[model samples]
Target chain A: MSRLIRGNAVSADDWTELDDATAVPSTAKVIVSLARWRAERETLAAATAIGVRVDNSADIQTLWPELRDLPLVALEFPKSGDGRAFSQARLLREHCGYQGEIRAIGDVQRDHLQAMQRCGFDAFVPRDDQDLDDCLRALHEFDLAYQRAARDDLPLVWRLRRQA
Target chain B: MYRYDEYDQKLVDERVAQFRDQTRRFLAGQLGEDEFRALRLRNGLYIQRFAPMLRIAIPYGLLSAAQMRMLAHIARKYDKGYGHFTTRQNIQFNWPKLPEVPDLLADLATVQMHAIQTSGNCIRNITADHLAGVANDELVDPRPYCELTRQWSSFHPEFNWLPRKFKFAFSASLNDRAATRVHDIGVHLVKNDAGELGYTIYVGGGLGRMPMLGHKIREFLPEVDLFSYLEAILRIYNLQGRRDNIHRARIKVLVKALGPEKFIELVEAEWAQIKDSYLKLLPQDIERMKGRFDVPAYVDETAADDGSYTAKLAADSKFAAWAKRNLRAHVRPGYAAVFVSLKANGVAPGDVTDAQMDALADLAEQYSFSELRATHDQNLVLADVARKDMYALWQRLSELGLATPNIGLLTDLICCPGLDFCSLANAGSIGVAQDIFDRFEDFDYQHDIGEIKLKMSGCMNGCGHHTVGHIGILGVDKSGEEWYQVTLGGSAENDAALGDRTGPSFSRADIAPAIEKIIQVYLEQRDGAEESFLHTYRRVGMGPFKARLYAKVSAETEVAA
Candidate 1:
């Protein structure tokens, strides 16, 4: 069983990812690939607790408008160096206004947590080799950041000015 | 020149603590080698050919005297008694133990300097004109904007892990001293038709295996929209740049593939969405940032030229020659900017000893208002030297062996740390530079050659900026033997252009002599002494030089068309 760090705690993942061939459960919380969700849109839409797993290269504009009612969106990293997901995550939160859980999956490690969190990822599925505790601690490595991002709309300069 | 605030201090302090822990874990065998490599690279630590090299960012080439003393202290105490100032205005220590780098970084943090994003796939140290606030021809100082960009790009969450390393250079001078056109994002501070200050942004220019000039994306981006516009460009690059191939991963490749028009359209669309976001710069923000770079207290009552200065110039030919070559026109009356040449013969281009660093610190305090700037040519500039003290400074510099009197000559070439220290070099560049220095030992002959930029790179990586050199040299390996390829007519000026290949490569022994042949052709073909090698090469094309270089056609197999 895989565990994910959700809201600063290592929690057992209740959601199951469904492949294209897997039969959709009638009432279970399930995640489906973008392709599967597109192919069986009507069937997946009617089900309770449905989520979509978007690949790093997928066009988020095509999926965001319809994802208004979804509770989860799993973004893929493929590998840690391929960082298209960071932009995708920001676009979903800042531009598309998707407030549901944006979970980072695939190649998610301790080092990637801080940056991922800043880009609006509230949930993370740690890599199998990494300890969940270590990944959680990595999120707090730096107490502050320099830029404005999805997590904080005001940059450090503006915040400091306000306090002054 | 921007001092760190409490927030800035906290970020760097936390970063040091984090890296220290990361180092401890790596040393304890808890962290994987590949994973640690990525982490260490973001902090500008690299396992090089000999030892771990640490590059410290000197933001926009500006350094205070106290910070310089700390650098000298690091050089003396850490590994060696010397450091190399790079073309991007950063200092690299070529021999530091991996375990000791954390301590070195801690030492740097005390002085408000860090190695953050100096070498990873992120926005690097934002560079600006070395003559930023001092040059007379500039429309406005670009350092404040550079500082803002530096802060914004540092630890940027969404853009840090890009497909390739990004670089930014800012220039406001009439002369493109910062080499903005060859950077990932080049910002030129310009005034619009209504006399309102703005930026002309250039996108996708770089100098690696495939060299390309940046395309002008925005002719006039208003001052308030700087960060928003920059963020839009960076976001597009982060998401869309090719990640599968390392060589073709730079933003230049993406911009080219999409075409400038299409790329501009995408950036404009993205900018339209984020124009009024929090990333937008407020007027007060710009004013506050500018306050940090406030002009130094310059002496207002000094004479334009004293009798003693004129007498000294008339008396000493050597002092006159040095002054002619090294002095730049300062905007402040009675003050002249002095370039301390690091390209002295028999020395590596930018390597300064610990003793020299300390002495230069003393000189900066005594002569130039306690500030120094690292130039793109790998030299140092005392930006506010008084005119009356010129002779005295020259005499002192002469004693220190810094009076090389060859600022723009052939001997003053840009050579990368090739096979000597770099792990990626195909051939050794320092030895070739030494050979050329030996050949052009005559100061008068070098003066005749005029302003010819001779830049060399060890490989196709182009860290030496070979593509923009007027006489560019690229080292290639031929069956385990070192060979050199030559290019002519490259310039990194306002009208930047990639150098054309002269012909087939030359052997290690033949490289210097081949350069002699090229210079010989230039001397014979030039209109007069007033016409520089670059101008003559441009006017006549590469035909005469190529004809001379490949005259022994039987010896060479492939000839450039």
Candidate 2:
């Protein structure tokens, strides 16, 4: 029952996140844990508009080939200081070329929103009690970036040289 | 020095604004302390023992005269009228107010300086040989590569919060003045047999509680694949480095745990996938970065033995002594690099007063092409002083109390700001250094003893590089008292090796006398005065020094009993 910042604006979250042991409802927008997705792969593959949640501990490379066509992939940050999910989000976008929707869930705060977005997290379910407006404002904090990420096609070095 | 472009300027400015907002949020109690601690540390703000210490990065230790003047002004206006230059080539104000750090950062950004990544669990400042562009034996100037790495590592999204703090050092000369062997990643820029530029990459070297020399991973990684290789290594470390224990989280431990062979395999596996990415540096990109570091103009004159210079040397023996010690051979024939000793008697090793800083700024404008550098030994350098202007510069520097003729002598010790300033320090380092200096106060005795690196660290963090000193002193806490453990034969040069610990630890009062006794052994049993303390220690093993130190300690204990 919370709003998510999806692709630069607040959006109504229609998806229902099901625990690993929960039963998947037919024709409902549902997100399941990586374990549940793997355990019920053939059954969940036939469902409509389904997503999978990958924990920071799980390797995103293992979910490839079968989970490539999912409409949504939510990466979890178990702790604010643990940045393993930032790499996972980049691997999903740049490595796997999954272009549907990448959401950042668990421990997401205003300080992490911009970097998370640059690494290809389009939807953010911020940590509870953080202001949504502040998280949105964090996106515009930096106008220039030095390295190339999933958001920028070319690095600032190349772009600056081209401009000159 | 690399000049910032419009993009670089804007990036720093925006970062300042971002941190300002973050500080506001933290003050408003919206952001928790744990979350704000990580952000503040990345920007080089530390809540220290007495007050907040703000470390401002001097990229590759290069600074313009204007920047030095600004630092002096900040020291005068913000905190006390002094600032401490660190071994990482950054200046730290130990008494800055917590709320005023953002404004101080804004002031630094005006001078094209920022403290970004100076601390925290990310890549720290990319240090180079202080004599980088001016060194006679340098293969290539390391500043360009350092700047490139700095930009790549700044605000890097994935590696921002690594398992522990990472450090990188670059050296291009035969002598490893940058201490490359003691860093997490040591890049030695070299030209291959084919006359093409490449790098010899070393990984897993670090100094702390566990000191291990870096293992050479790749002997010839091409210049173009530098960033890709670095990214590959960092990705491996980020994913695999230990996160359960903060003490064992540095990449060195991971490299040791997996062994260099397995670590290389993992990094190569990762590199095979991402080698073709946009992180690869193009020739034009290298050229563009190099263009920012244009060489300064030099006069075409040889360093002839002029009558005036000879007469000055003959007239003042002190000037001759200072010249023999403080001057280094510059790449330019007529010029010499001057090492301004910050380790004057009784003063803290790297602490400089505002007046001294302003005087150095003025001197840089007058003689050294308006440029200065902070050496890793916590000293300042005027890198382009002319041979003819040497005497005049020495006279002026003497007037400022900076003309100490102990550049590489026994008294030129690198001592950390220990318990006086650092909250993590277990004992006082500067007090011990002062004690050693008082014992060896005679210039003639110091010159006679010759070429001994006496480094002291207040704690096991080894910021003072005590592990690699020829005579290393580590401050330990024995219950509630400060005790020092001495080591022998460590070096940070091309033949880098960790020192072996001498017998048992000594009390703070007995530490200096124990060192004197060790030096006494070297003096008595050396081949000649030509043999340095290190060479002598190497030739005759540590047995003699250990025996002498312990004999004295036993006699003193027996007398007390």
Candidate 3:
């Protein structure tokens, strides 16, 4: 089990990730792989609360229109160095307009939290060894950002103009 | 030069603190080497063969006198008492200790300079034409756009960890001095039919293991749509570019894999979604950024009083030769842009000593408008030098061993820090450059065979831009010995083309003679003195040059036997 940081708070993660071989439970909050979700969309969509996990290699645009209303969508960072999840998060937010809980899972670290948040990840399942407090502090590393992101609607340039 | 505001200052200061902590963690064994490597690389620190090299960004090659002095100070205090300017318009310190890099970065930040994004898989230093604002044929000054892109790309959230390194070059002149066509993303400022300024966007161009010219994706992108369009292109590249292989991971490979049509379609799809977002630049944003690059105040002087300059040129043949080679026409009347040659015979092409840097800084203050630019050709330029002060500046430069008068000559070569410094280099580049310099040391001879660009790289990485030189030389390793492969007819100008390989690779001893034979063929075949080496090669084709180069090698071998 890992500590889950959801929108600036340490939250008890009720969500259970099910492998493709496992059977889907109807009443529990279950997250499944993108393949399993596609294979059993109707059965998974009818659940009380559901989520889908996407790999870095998965075509994120294919997930939209069919899987838009899921309560959560977790993007996988297969390794600490791989950054395809960042692009996936942005596409989910800006292109698909998916406003549900977006979580960063698998190899998440303190150093990646700020960038993950800016790319529309509202929740992060940090690696098991990282301290939760350290992960939380990482989000506040920069008080100002130049580009407009999920957290900041207006970029710094526009905000500065308004202030002046 | 673009002065850092409070916001920019705070960002750099915080970055310094962050790197200091990261370095401490790495030294304390809290972080592994692989983990710390990525962190340190984002700060522009590279672990080279001999020592750690830190590349400091010059930001479009523009520098104030104070900044130049700070660089000199750092060169003296931190590593060896010298630094090398890179083709990307940045400088590298070849010998800084690993433990003291945080302190070095702190020192750099004090002078409004940092090595951030100068290395690693991010948008590197945005380079512009060295003659940006002062060039007579410029359409618009490119420094403002370069500065804007620098700000936009700095610590960018999504694009910082790119699949491969991304390079951006901007040019707004008739002459493509910035080598835009060879960059990952090249922006050429253009004016539409309605007289509205815009950009011609090119993507996918890069050199390295695989060299390809960037394809023009957008013929006219409105000035306001700059950041949005850039964001779209980067996002698509980040997700779609290959990650399975490091060699095929640059945006060029991705763009080539999916043809330009499909790539443009995807970019358009992404842009359509984000076009109206806050990422779009407002008119005020453009104006505000433009205001940062305020033009230097010029005294209204008439060109009618250049009799003294003309008389000085007439009286001294040496001064006339130097002026002809080292001076360029400035946009302002009665002024000339002076190129201070860093390619003096014995020195590495771009390496400058601490004392020389200080002297150049002082000279910039005295002659130019207290500003200087590091050219992509590894030289310094006093952009706004008055013609009246040309004789004095030349005399001072001559005393400093900087008046080589070999700008655009064969000896004015671009070379990478090869096996002596770079771990990736297969052979030594500076040694070959020195050998060629010795072979072509005569000034009159160099003038007779005019305007040849010789670029040599120690490896296939092409940091020296050998793939685009008129006479390109690539160093290869055959078992344990150093050999060189030569190419011909390549250029980096408006009509940029990759060089075609000449016949066979030559040994180190024969490389200089091979080049001389190639030059000999050009001189023999050229119509007149007006034709440059590249022009002659293009007109006559490479058949004759190749035949002569290889035939001479066989003739020499038989004579020796």
* Candidate 1 residue lDDT tens string, A80-135: 77889999999999889889999999988798888999999999998888978888
Per-residue CA lDDT of candidate 2, range B1-561, in tens?
577888888889989998998899899998889999999999999999999999999988999988999999899989899999998899999988878888999999998999998899998999999999999899999899999999999988888989899999999999999999999999999999999999999999988899989999999999999988998899888888888998899999999999999999988988888888888888888888899985777776654323466688899999999988998999887788999999999799998999999999999999888899998999999999877888889999999989999999888999888999999999999998898889999999999998889989999999999999999999999998999999998988898999999979999888999989988999998889999989999999989998888886689889999
- The residue pairs in collision within model 2 are none
Give the TM-score of candidate 1 (chain A): 0.91
Tens-digit per-residue lDDT, B455-505, candidate 1? 999999998899999999999999999999999999999869999998789
Please give, as one word, the docking class of candidate 1: medium
Q: Model-by-model lDDT, in order?
A: 0.90, 0.89, 0.88
Residue B64 displacement in candidate 1 (angstroms): 0.9
Number of the top lDDT candidate: 1
Candidate No. with top DockQ: 1
Q: Is candidate 1 or candidate 3 better by lDDT?
A: 1
Estimated TM-score per prediction? 0.97, 0.97, 0.97
